[model samples]
Target: MSKTQQLSKIGNFFRAFGSAVAVAEATRLGHQPVASDLRALGIDPVQFKSIYRR
Candidate 1:
């Protein structure tokens, strides 16, 4: 996707998360929770630095 399209998708996710938080105090995700899934676990999400991305 183009940069703009990627940003739009990220915006959509933020909107979804905002709505979800408003609807319920907590959001659940399937399987074991990893560091990346922390947001769904009602905690702050963190991004680890990868050689390519960071």
Candidate 2:
């Protein structure tokens, strides 16, 4: 892969990792995670809410 593509992939990976961490922290705190963060993790925010159903 090109250097630019490799860098892009790394950046995306970090962003997704950050989103996952944010989601975990929010859930741990008994709060709903941000919709954008859920999307970053390839999750549908609405479905996630339904599954949790609080």
lDDT tens digits, residue span 1-54, model 2: 999999999999999999999999999888899999999999999998877544
Note the residue pairs that clash in candidate 2: none
User: What is the Cα-based lDDT of residue 29 in candidate 2?
Assistant: 89
* Each candidate's clash count: 0, 0
TM-score result, candidate 2: 0.89
lDDT of each candidate versus the true structure: 0.50, 0.93
Q: Which residue segments of model 1 deviate by more than 4 Å?
A: 25-54
Model 1 lDDT tens row, 1-54? 899999999997896676555434323322223443455535543332121221
lDDT of 1 at 26: 28
Q: Candidate 2: minimum summed lDDT over ten consecutive residues — where?
A: 45-54
